[model samples]
Target chain A: MVRRSREPVLWAMFSGGGMIAALLLPATVAVLWIAAPLGWVEAPSYEGLRLLFLHPIGRLSLFAVATLSFFHWAHRFRYTVYDGLQLYHLSQLIAILTYSIAVALTVIAGFVLVTTG
Target chain B: MAKALNAGYKRHYPKWHRERVPIFWWLRSASYVKFMFRELTSLFVAYAAGLLLVQAWVLGQGAAAHARLLNWLSHPAVVTWHVILLATLLFHTVTWLNLTPQALVLRLGRWRVPKTVVWAGHYAAWLVLSLVIVCLFVGVA
Candidate 1:
């Protein structure tokens, strides 16, 4: 019998998160930070943007992006410290700490999204 | 009756590089450091997402809260941070898109898609997304 490791599952999440981040983050940053602040575009009113977020789809989308991005960070940082810093001996501890923070932040994101009405 | 061929065979010891990799190995090579910087951008990506969450929280609190949050975000330090993050995020996006073909191999029947084609597809998708976002933000769509 062959045994499998859980690394693949984490890698899948990381890859998925990468796709989402690549597809979404640039446009988001452009709109929120660049276009709006620089006045290159007619930025939405604060009330309008907030109303959009209060909608179910907007909240869900934000939560998904946040959750995936955090997992992406967790996976990347896990390798960064483990391999980049040559801390392979502390792999288990590092993974736990990194993943724990990601999960905690994800929960905080969820809390902020759902309760922000 | 087999010949004694084994009698003349010699055993050699396995050789190793022996030299340990230095702690700052990435600094020695531009390519290595570039790769490291690409990997490092994930931190800022996470930061951007977390900041968005905070904005959502503040927006939920009400107008004054959101106003204060926006004001804070507009500070010089915050603007500088955003600029840095935007650059990293752009790098992340470009590299991720460039590497997409390697990760995702699309097949049609017995034929495999060419990497350049796949790369072009990713760029096209990115262009469409950015345009749509621009339209939405500018009230063109």
Candidate 2:
């Protein structure tokens, strides 16, 4: 019997994350890091931003993006190391480490999102 | 009888081995280099998500902590880093969207959607989503 490869599941996450990052990260980074700090856009008051994040929808969206993005990183970085670095001998170890880190970060992000006001 | 006669074939035959690829092979071609850079964009993606997570964590700490994060972001070095991040992210976006037509083949009944149309649609969606995010941040929405 052939064991099923889990690559498809990881690839799905990778593509989904890539899509979300492509669609959202540019504007998010531009607004938060560039425009807001430079006074090109009105920066949200800390209280206002906090209240938004404290809302359930805000928390859910943040969690979704952060978690998917991390998984995207894990899948890509795993292949980068495997092929780019030619570390085929350590494939199993690399897969484990990359996905584990992604999962760990997701947990931390979830906790922060849940606890934050 | 044939199986018994061929039982020692493995011992007589030489093993086949794959040619080793050079570690820096991606540097040899422009396209390969671009692909490597595209893969490298994942790091920036992770960085952006991690930064947002940190921001959320800081927001929970207190107003002073959140303010400190904003102040830190305004520093020259950090701002420069973010500029690089934005560039890399845009590269990722363009490359990813360009590949969408290949990955997704749309059919309108018997007529297939034109690749150009599919490609343009992705770009349009990307533009709209980006605008939406910007509007959210700017409190326009």
Candidate 3:
């Protein structure tokens, strides 16, 4: 019996993350980092943002984007180390480290999202 | 007799050797450099997500902490870094969306959707999503 490789699952997450990042990250970065800071757009007040996060939908969407983006980073960074650094000998270690970091961050993000208003 | 001869010949052959690819091989080609740049965008994507997590955590810490975060974000150096981050993110968005038509093939009954149309559809969706997010954050303030 052949043991299935988990590459497909990781690849699916990476693909989804890439799609989400593409569709969402631009405006997010623009608004949060650039426009709001530069006063080109009004920044969301602390109270306003907190109220937004208090809603289930906002928390869920934020969690989904952050989690998927991290997985995307893990998958891509795994390969970047493999091919870019030519560390094929340490492939298993790299895979474990990257995915573990993503999972750990996901847990932290989830905890914060759940506990916070 | 032929099998015996072939087996003996194989025993005398040297092991195959493959040349090691240099770590900076991608830098040698324009397209390879572009590919590496695209791959490197994952770092910024991860950074953005991590920043969001931090922001959420700060939000939970109370308004003083959140205000501190906002002040930090508004600093000249930090804003400069964000400008660079935004450029890389837009690059990621454009390259990722451009590749979508190739990855996803759309069909309507017997007719295949043109790649241009598929490509345009993704861009349209992206624009709408960007608008939605911008409104959610900016308009509400």
Per-candidate TM-scores read: 0.89, 0.92, 0.92
Pairs in steric clash, model 2: none
**Pairs of residues clashing in candidate 1:** none
Compared with the true structure, all predictions reach lDDT values of 0.83, 0.90, 0.90
Of the candidates shown, which would achieve the greatest lDDT relative to the real structure?
3
Error of 1 at A35 (Å): 2.6
Put down candidate 2 lDDT per residue, A30-113, tens digits, no spaces. 998988887888997787777666668878888989999999999999999988999999999999999999999999998899
Tens-digit per-residue lDDT, A1-113, candidate 1:
88898889889878877888898888888777766765666766777777666679889988988999999999998998877887778999999998899999989988888
RMSD of each: 6.5, 2.9, 3.6
- Say which prediction, candidate 2 or candidate 3, comes out ahead on lDDT: 3
Q: Candidate 3: misplaced stretches above 4 Å?
A: B1-14
Q: How would you encode candidate 1's per-residue C-alpha lDDT over B13-125 as one tens digit per residue?
A: 46767566677878888998988898888998898899888878887888898878767766778777777888899999999999988988999998999999999999999
- What are the per-residue Cα lDDT tens digits for candidate 2 across B87-116? 999999999999999999999899999999
